[model samples]
Target: MGRKLMSTLAVLSLILQTISAMNVICYHGTWSRYRSGNGSLKISDIDASLCTHYIYAFVGLDSSTYEVVSLDSWLDISLNGFADAVALKESNSNLKVLLAIGGWNEGSAKYSTMASNSTNRATFISSVISMLQTYSFDGFDVDWEYPARRDSTNSEDKENFALLLKELREAFDTYGFILTAAVSATPSSADISYDVPSLSTYLDSINLMEYDYFGAWDDVTGHNAPLNGQSVYFGTTYAEYNLHSSVYGWIERGADPSKLALGIPLYGRTFTLSNSSSNGVGAAVSGAGPAGPYTASAGFLGIQRDFGRVR
Candidate 1:
């Protein structure tokens, strides 16, 4: 086993060396937040060139990730608008418009159901692919809230999630379309139940949700994306707490970083505990911090609006 492990490490090192040449794909979160006063949104604030290879707009579907309703749920809102804006900036070239299915609030139940039945699964995939064809989406991102336990959603959903990905990969590959998934940041051997190597064989990339390391949810305070911190926290502050460490963790778990994209949140989490220290410790007052620097309290839309004005 030790000999086999070393051999695997050697191969991974080689893969790593080759992967750096691959583009560093980056994505923006929540396009609905970027609506301008005229109801027009421009993604120039994000700088299309910064996206090494592909850029994706994080779209929410019917308030759920798995329950993908109509394409209008995305096309009608700022998500599609953002895609068009980005596509226009890219000279109508492919920027890989991917609709992320499932989110923090949505669970893997929807995915499980979709994968359980063959006909329903085919219909779902067909609908999504058709949307991609109509709107020219490069691929789809499956964010199943979570697979296996240690967070929200059920552990049993892991296998079903894998099955869905397998089918998606087979279908998408035929047309040269991309298929990526947003996987959990921290996953153990059996904890994930996802065959990483098998998954790597099929999909284009696996975006590790490296953000949200810490939040206001904990009884004790911590950075959301802390490095070398006791536990996961907000803000990708330290080397150990930031995206680098998260990426390393994924690499260690057999995921190829080349096929992995880092998730950066445009929005920051705020705590309003009166007694809390400004150093990002202790408790805070009941008041909430405004989303942006100037705004009183800006949500996703408000912030995106501010960003578009600057662009």
Candidate 2:
């Protein structure tokens, strides 16, 4: 009986150790942008405990040189308060915190300019390293809106992006810090912007932005991350064409699977289709509803406003 009990304890210890050390972490945006004046952040209906790790907020990329910058003075608040709070209250010593640089609205042009010069690249890398060291950030997430081509106007910006990633990765390696980038969804976007095989070694992970599969941009309607169908081939579904599909694609192109992280959105996308009957019965949706009804705000305000508390 004693021998059997010892073996069971050993197996349980191994499982617990593996669970504690896993690196799959989820991300959230800056708190001040969505939270009330009291500086509260919550994680919606999702159980915070289930998430292996959490990336507290995105720190915007510097426009002048593509370096990371703190917006709204919330960087200090998070470092001094929130990050520490998570560690203490949760007793999660292995928790990893990342400062995400760049975002959709930030554009990739400045990254273009910064990468064009060796001197500027040096300066930009130094700034990012300093930011990480000061904040004790475990990693950095680059969210360049689009590269290798975007919306006709930014088409010329693609090739320069690969160069930027190369330089950034080399710098990150020397510092022994993890480097990651958020890639575009469509294969066209990925082909044009990322140099996957070469980039894979330099990066710790490639976080695919699997959301925004359908929205007002298109004249028709579609789900954000559907499970199957035509959109699935386009990388639209998380359960179907999601992390597994994306990581496999990268692996086929020479990327390491261990370095891949899947991006999931806590919010849902709503659309107004022209053919009501085609959309199914009672398909008329509105950003603003009738009296005493709720109103719609851009992006995922619902997640931040109501879902980011530490406890």
Candidate 3:
């Protein structure tokens, strides 16, 4: 009886330890505040309990000064986006609000230039520290789309990117703050752009954006964020772009499994069907689906409307 009781206690303790280590990171897009007709989503709208870390999507770089610049002054500054987000901690003390820098279509030229030169890197590092201090942000999230890509990036960026992260990590450590990054999920892109093993050394977490595998850009329709690659069509190995494959690929490439967070899409990608009858995985697609009424893009809320119509 004593042995059975001890084993039961050990199992419960192990389960609790596992649960405590889990992190639920959520990206809160500031632009969501400007949804078409409806009033924008306020920081108060977020359920503090849902996420351990809330990242404010995108604060850009000043091309000349390398200082952080807000794309939306009203939301970021006047509205006190950082302060408001951090306010959630009043209710949930464990909640951490991080400022995410750069994003898709934000361009990589600035980042490449900043990372490549030591002077620029130092300036950028100081700017980040200053911003964090001013805004009371708990940490920083680097979202430099791609490092050594053909688009607005140079080959030297791969090495410089690692240097940038190392410096940033050092600065973050000085303040005892968190350092995280949003990285590409595509295996080829990840391999070329990042020094994954080195990145894991400095970063507290890597948000793996496994979504957007297929959308308006693709000629063929595919799952936006498939859990497994088994459903992929034959003859097309490209369908291996799924959550499982992406996470495993990063781990295999040397990213720490515990430090990697699989990013889940709050919005769904929409594709126009060329042949409604052939609406399955790998079906031909003409173009992007219609924009959402509120989001003005192919967002989940828009898809919800279609789902309602069918129901």
Which candidate number has the best TM-score? 3
Off by over 4 Å in 1: 1-22, 33-41, 44-46, 53-67, 71-86, 92-94, 148-155, 188-190, 230-245, 274-311
Which order, best to worst by lDDT?
3, 2, 1
Write candidate 3's Cα lDDT for 1-311 as tens digits.
11011110011100000112457887776676655444246678778787788888778898898878887888788888778877888878987888988876466888888888899899998988998988888999998877886455568887899899999998889997889988888667778789999899989888777666766677877776688884538355664577787878888889888888776654556677899999887888898777556555542233333344332
lDDT of 1 by residue, 1-311 (tens): 11001110011100111124545555433433333343333454444444444434434343233335543355445455535544744642534455555555444455555666677667777877876777666678776555553343444565666677888888988888878776665544224556676667677887665555544443434454444544333244333444556567667767765786655443334544556454455344354443443332322113333344432
Candidate 2, residue 183: the lDDT equals: 71
- Give lDDT tens digits, candidate 2, residues 131-231: 88876777677776665433323454555566667887887787777777767644445666777776676676777665555544344445554434444
Candidate with top lDDT is 3
TM-score, every prediction: 0.68, 0.71, 0.88
After TM-score superposition, the amount by which residue 8's alpha carbon in candidate 3 deviates from its true location, in angstroms, is 49
Q: lDDT of candidate 2?
A: 0.52
Cα displacement (angstroms), candidate 1, residue 82, comes to 7.3
Winner of 1 and 2 under TM-score: 2
